[model samples]
Target: MTEAAAQRAGRDAEAAPSLLYLVKRTEQAVRARLDEVLKPAGVTALQYTALTVLERHDGLTAAQLARDSFVTAQSMADMVRTLEARGHVVRSPNPVNRRELLIALTELGHRLLDDYRRPVRELEHRMTGGLSAPEVDQLRAALDSAWRQLN
Candidate 1:
């Protein structure tokens, strides 16, 4: 084969989708889309995820937030520090365990989350616009299973 033909053949072979490739690509696209939409509001996707978790389950320790947010403890600490500095989160001594610090969303944090709700929902709608509700559920289940298998 000519060099051009050889390169085309290689590209064709790599284009055959695998679950891993598809998942990674989807994650990248989703993150990019979220970042673009959230930039004006001043939060990255990871920061938004941390905020969302805290909103749902308040008063979690830094370590717990790290696990829930799928981030390293060090990164979570940094994120928490940044959020606290921005007045979006507050850290207090865990009453039950004085050694650990429990983090909670401040009123500002709640306000920020509330502000993003509509945009985030619209983004989700756009993402799943092609899929039926059942398919969306199945996709969620399959992804959850895959995550459980790996972790």
Candidate 2:
């Protein structure tokens, strides 16, 4: 190839965003959508994620919830307090670790999740609407693999 053609090709490649950039962009878009969808429920996307994590693992420390919910420990502490104040979650002394309190979802939290289930599902469907079932499966696998590799 001519040197000028090769230089143009290199510039074009450099102009394209990296895979990681695309992945993070997608995450941002999803979070924005979640914020809109959950706004009526009076919950932010991060809070909803924490509640879901607690739903899956009933009792976890603020630090654990923070890690799972992709927030800082301080942020999780604040969130726990907010959720508790809202009667969506409760904190009790951990039987295994008396000094630490475990956060758990309350009945109200579960109901909140149930109420938003359909909307959340619809959001997910919209995300993958362009892909075939097999392609969706592959996308999930690929994303999971990437996560596992980094994690």
Candidate 3:
């Protein structure tokens, strides 16, 4: 290949946005669409995700759930309060740790989650439309590696 052609190729590559920028933009688009789809259910995606985590790890503290779900403690606290008001979550004295309160999904919480679970799964797939299974796996691996490298 001629030197001029090689230089032109390098310039074209440099002119394109980095993969990280595209990934971040795509993530934002997914979040925006999810939030829109979740609006009618009267629950944000974050709230629903936290509830899912609580379902998986029943009787978890707000702190524990926050850490597991990658959310802030204050955000979890707010969600718990909202869920409690909606009759979806029950906060009780921690049996093992009296000093801190533990949160659990009430029977109502489980039912409500069940109702929304189908739509949630559908929305997730829709948001990730056009991505193949292997492509999704590659994205996951890349993100996990990036997170570990950064933190």
Candidate 4:
């Protein structure tokens, strides 16, 4: 490479701000904190996300849950197995689709979800703690718009 191009590349790496990098870094911090909170209960960050999906959309298939959380079906299936073994979820034949299985949170899962509710809310509060409600709302809307545009 030419000297000028090499210097420009070095400068870009040193000073450029990447939106993708910022988003991933913030997500990693939040995930680390959440994992710290959930680990005591034998829950992983990925499992917690699966549980959150079940809470929002009960009776979702493992495939559906995977899609909801940006995971592969195989990974979600493994998580569902772990959750099932822990008595936090149950899997059954999909009522309408004979070939597919449906996954749902058990009563134990519901109770566990209720039990750990505070930490998740606390995490969100911490994430937006410095912002006023209006600012938070605006940020949310902007994020929603951007996500829709990109995705």
Best by TM-score: 2
Q: Across residues 100-122, which tens digit of lDDT does each residue of candidate 4 receive?
A: 98999999888878878998889
Ranking by TM-score: 2, 4, 1, 3
Greater TM-score among 2 and 3 belongs to 2
lDDT of 3: 0.86
Q: What TM-score quantifies how close candidate 4 is to the native fold?
A: 0.86
**Cα RMSD (angstroms) for every candidate in the order listed:** 4.4, 1.2, 2.4, 4.3
Q: What is the C-alpha lDDT profile of model 1 across 1-151, one tens digit per residue?
A: 9999999999998888988888899888988998998899788999999999999999999999999998999999999999999898999998888999999999999999999999999998898899999998998899899999989
Superior candidate under TM-score, 1 versus 2: 2
Q: Candidate 4, after superposition: displacement of residue 29 in Å?
A: 0.6
- For candidate 1, list the clashing residue pairs, or say none: none
| TM-score of candidate 2 on Cα atoms, chains taken together | 0.95
> TM-scores of all models?
0.86, 0.95, 0.81, 0.86
Over 4 Å off in model 1, which ranges?
Answer: 1-15
Task: For each candidate in the order shown, give its overall lDDT on alpha carbons.
Answer: 0.93, 0.96, 0.86, 0.89
Misplaced by over 4 Å in model 4 are 1-14
User: Candidate 4, overall lDDT?
Assistant: 0.89
Name the best candidate (by lDDT).
2
Better of 1 and 3 by lDDT: 1
